[model samples]
Target: MFDLDRWIEIFQTLSKNKLRTVLSGFTIAFAILLFTLLFGIGNGLKHTFEEQFKGDAQNSIYIRSGRTTKPYKGLQSGRRIQFRNEDSKFMNDKFSEKIQFFSPNIERFNVQAIYKGEQNSYTVRGVYPDYQALEEAVMEQGRFLSVLDIKNKAKVVAIGRLVEKDLYGQLSALGKNITLGGISYKVIGVFSDPGGDNDERFIYTPFTTAQGIYKPNDEVDRYGLTFNPSLSVDQALSFSNLLTKLLKEKHNVDPRDQRAIRVQNYAEGTKNVEQFMGVLNIIILFIGIGTLVAGIIGISNIMVYIVKERTKELGIRKALGATPKSIIGMIMMESIFVTALAGYAGLLLGVFTLNALGDSLEKYFILNPSVETYVVVGATIILIIAGTVAGYIPAKRAARIKPIVALNDE
Candidate 1:
């Protein structure tokens, strides 16, 4: 299979027609390059979407009440809807099987926190022990809030990773005393959240303690819960819809009102994201196929032109005892070699460019774009095969041309 003489002939022919060789190579190379870049960028866009949703539990749902914009059933417009402890009991009783984890959230912003000489303003939330799971927080030190802490109305707080960093510095915040709003509390845990810096700056306390201290009348700011993980996205969405409708009815709010009782379901967002990602995958596949098709056409045209230009040379060889098979084989070998080499060069360049453009395209919502080696290599192999097939058509016709006719015509 390793024909040194045949390869030498190919090399001589290629060197003699440098322009033809470069033209053929560039066609395939540019196609592969464009294909690689497009595929990499598509993957990067997917990564961005995944990153955005990674901040929260995929199955979590949040409920927040706001001022109603429309009047309903004798109630005036602009009525402020309030969530309460009774609402928590209502959800647990109504959807016991569908709810996995639930927490009534009462948040305080700009809360002044002091740990010895360190002082900062951080967000403070009052939530049940299940709030940890709802927020998808991981305990970095000590432990998260416990049922016993809530039951005892313990003056214990679980601070965020950044909260500890800002106040306690390198020293551990666990089991230390931290003062918040002129009230002293023992630090029981330090947790980190995937939601990034904003989430990691929060301090959490027992719902009972905060409700008693801040709102003794039993008012809740919002509700956070995760649906049962076994539920499908559609089922989760239905559950949230029913929950929102029921909450609105319980509060005597307008059913058509958008702002009265808002249910923010991650499932709905996930369904939309899945649909988008599906479309994105289809688009990427289309672009890749289109790029490959264009490359094939370009290389095919160039191969035909190369054969046409070498018509006289092929005829002279045939007259000099060159077999038709040898003539076709030489042309095919030359075309395939150039195609494979150029395609690989283009692939490497595209990959290197993606690596160099890493993170720089994040502002464009493209994260660490890259292409798999097998994908690009497969494309290159396909181009080489196309070149060989394309070259064979013209080579076969040239092989049939009579030497006398070819020589007289030229």
Candidate 2:
């Protein structure tokens, strides 16, 4: 199996046509490199898109009030639609089983926040305890708002990381007091949001406290609702539609007026994004496979030319009692050696490029572009099979050469 003479002959044949061999190897290498990079880029794009949805629950919906644009039941066309605390309670009573988490918000924009002598204006909102999970807020230093805080109407506040930096300036913000609009509240938590600095500039307080001190009239600005996780995307959207219709009827808003109530279903958005990414992946796969097929065809054509040029040598070996199997094996071995080396080089270069650029690309949301181990193994197996197939036809032709005819050719 380890024939030194056979190895010497193979090396000698390859060395005779160095330029042609290098060109053949380059074609295979380029194909593999292109495929690996395309696949890596596709994965990076998918990762980036997923990051954009990390700020909220996958099955969440946001409902906000707007002015009615159409007349209904003899009401005027320009009636301002508003949600109240009573509506939130009614929805909880009606859909307790279908709902997972619900939060009613009342917001005051450009509220001045003061800690010690430093003061800055930020958006302040009143929300229930469940708003923490609904907004995907991670506690960096202290605990989030508790249900007890909401029920007791405690004057406690949860500030974001950016707010903590601005007000407290590297000091422990937990258990400290911060004044909002001349009203002092104890800091109970500091949170970080995945949506970056914009989401991290707000302050959260108990809805009851805000309603009591600010609105005092039971007015709600918006509602955040998340359905049971077991529900499908379409089912969740249907439930949201039903809830919207009921709210419109109850508030005397026109059912056909889309402007009266704005509902944003994150699940529906995620589905559309996934569908687009699926099409993108298919396109990349097609291009990669097409390039690889072209390279394999080139290898096959080169093998045919090599065989034709070596006809005289093959015939002389046949006359010296060489068997058809030996001739075929020689040709196949050369093809496999060349393709395997080229494919390996391509794999290494592709992985190295991704690793070198991973850090720089993270700002653009393209992170950790890589191919899996199984994929690399699969590509190698495919290369070996392709090599065998590429040489098969030429190997057969070499085996069929007549010793006398081949030797007589000029």
Candidate 3:
């Protein structure tokens, strides 16, 4: 099967038509290059979308109160809806199995934080221990708020990395006091957020402490919940809808009023994004395969031309006792070699391009864009099959050449 002499003959034939061979090879190479680049870019887009979901739990849902848009149950429209600690407790008690984590968020705007005579204005929030996981906060030092802190209304603060740096400036803030709204609270922890520096400008305290200090009564700004991982997106959405309905009923808001109880289903958002990416991948594949089909057609046409030009030589070989199978094998081998070599060049170029831009692209949320090894192997197989098929009809024509007829052709 390994015929060195036959390979040498095939190379000689290809070398004789240098321009034609180069053009044919270029077509195949360009097609593969386009396919690789499009696929890599599609993957990059997917990575960018995924990075946006990193700041929160994938299945998390947020519930916030808004002004009523329609009157219901004798209540007038335009009534501002508000949530309290009782509502959070009721939801936690009622949906214990369905919920993974729940936190009632209480926000105070433009709060002054003073530490060692250095003061800066930042938004302050009161949250529970579960808010740590819900917000995907990474503790850089000390510990986050605990259940005991909330129960006892402890005057302890967990500051963000930005807040710590602004107020303390490289010095350890733990066990140190910070005056928030004129109330002295000991620093307990410092945290970093996936959402970058903007998210690190807020400080967190125990919900009870915030309620006591801010005197917003029992009112909370919003509620955050993450569903159990075992639930599907549809299932989680159904649960969110049920919760919304229950809240509307409990708060005496209109059942059909959408604005009274606003719920953000992160699971649904993520699912929609994934569906969009699926469509994007399909579009990329369609265009890539279309380019490859054109290249294959070009290879087929060139092989036919090669056969036509070498009809007399093929006939001479037949007359000299060469078998039809050997002639077909020679033609097919040439087609395969040209395609494989060009494909390798395209693959190498695509990989090198991705590697060169990987670092720069990461700043835009695109991680390493690469084709898997198995996909590359599969593409190589496809190239070989395509090369053989492209040459098949031409090789058969060469095999059927009659020595007498071919010798007479000018």
Candidate 4:
């Protein structure tokens, strides 16, 4: 199967025709390179979209209250709506099955947290044990807030990893006392969040402890909960809508009031994200298909031109008693070889470029741009096949032509 003389002849021809070789190689290489880069950038965009939405649980919903914007049931438009422990109980009693991991929050910003001589301003939240899941916090050093801690109003806190680092330096914050607003709480845990730095800088304390210390009575600032994961996006939206409507009615707000009670549903935003991602996928697929088609066409035309330019040479071979099969085989082999080399070169170059880029494109939201190895290899094979087919047609035509006519052409 290994024909040494044929290979030598092929190499000799390629080396002698430098322009032809470079033209063919460049066509295949550029096509493959373009396709790889475009696909990598598209995937980078997809990664950016995913990262943007990873700040909270995918099924999360937040309920917050503001002053009523419209009068209803004799209530004035300027009435300030509020969430309370009674509202939390009402939600649990009414929508127990629809809700998952509910938490009533009492949040305070610019809280001065002091540990020994170190002090910093941070956001502190009083939350239920289930708040860990709501915030998607993972316990790194110890345990999160327990139900017993909430019931007993324990002076214990779960500090974020960044909070611990900022105050405790390299020393562990676990079991240490941190004073917030002159009230000292023992650090029972340290947590990390995928939600990034801002989330990481928060301090979580037992709901009852913070509530008793900060609130006038049983007041809650806001509520956060995740819906049942089994629910479809439409079902989740419906659940949130019903919950919003009921909350509005319970508060005596107008049905059309926009600011009295508001629900922020992650699922609603995810629906738009899904739609955009679908359109994006279609666009990427279209671009890839279009690029492959253009590459095939370009290589096919170039192969045909190469054959035309060598018509006299082919005629000379025919006169020397070379068979039609040998003629087609030689041309096809050269075209395939060139295409294979160029394609591989493109693949390596594309991968190297992506690696060299690293996270430098993060500002542009193009993180870790790359293409799968199999994908690039398959694309290269396709080009090689296209080159063979392109060379076959013209080679067959050249072989059929009378040797005298080909040699006589000016």
| Backbone N/Cα/C clashes per model | 0, 0, 0, 0
Using TM-score as the measure, the top candidate is: 4
- Residues 1-410, candidate 2: write the lDDT tens digits: 68899889989988998987898788778877777887887788888788778788888889999998998999998889878888998899988988998999989999999999999999999999899878889999888888899999999999999999998897988999999999999999999998789889989999999989887788899999889988888888888899989999899988789999988999888889889898988998788778777877878887888788888888998999999899999989888888898888888888888878786888877767777756655665686678778887888977887899878756
Candidate 1 residue pairs in backbone clash: none
Model 3: per-residue Cα lDDT at residue 34: 71
After superposition, candidate 2 runs with Cα above 4 Å error: 1-9, 319-323, 351-377, 400-410
Give lDDT tens digits, candidate 1, residues 1-410. Answer: 79899898889888988988899999998999999999999989988888888868899999999999999999999999998889999999999999999999999999999988899999999999999998789999999899999999999999999999999898998889999999999999999999899999999999999999998989999999999999999999999999999999999999999999999999988999899989998999999999999999999899898888888888788889999999998988898899999998899889999999999999999988988889899999999999999999999999999987776655
Output the lDDT of residue 89, model 2: 87
Q: List candidate 1 segments past 4 Å from native.
A: 319-321, 359-367, 400-409
| Ranked candidates, highest TM-score first | 4, 2, 1, 3
lDDT of 2 at 222: 94
RMSD of 2: 2.9
Clash pairs, candidate 4, are none
Candidate 4 per-residue C-alpha lDDT over 1-410 given as tens digits, one digit per residue, 9 for 90 to 100:
99999999999999999999999899899888888887788788888888887868999999999999887887789899988899999999999998989999999999999998999999999999999998889999999999999999999999999999999999999999999999989999999999999999999999899999999689999999999998999999999999999999898889899888989999998999899889987898788878878989999999999999999999899999999999999999999999999998988888888888869989998877888788888888898999999999999999898899889866
What is the lDDT ranking, best to worst?
Answer: 1, 4, 2, 3
Residue 276 alpha-carbon offset, candidate 2, angstroms: 1.4
Sliding window of 10 residues with minimal summed lDDT for model 4: 367-376
Is candidate 2 or 3 superior in lDDT?
A: 2
**How high is each candidate's TM-score?**
0.88, 0.89, 0.86, 0.92
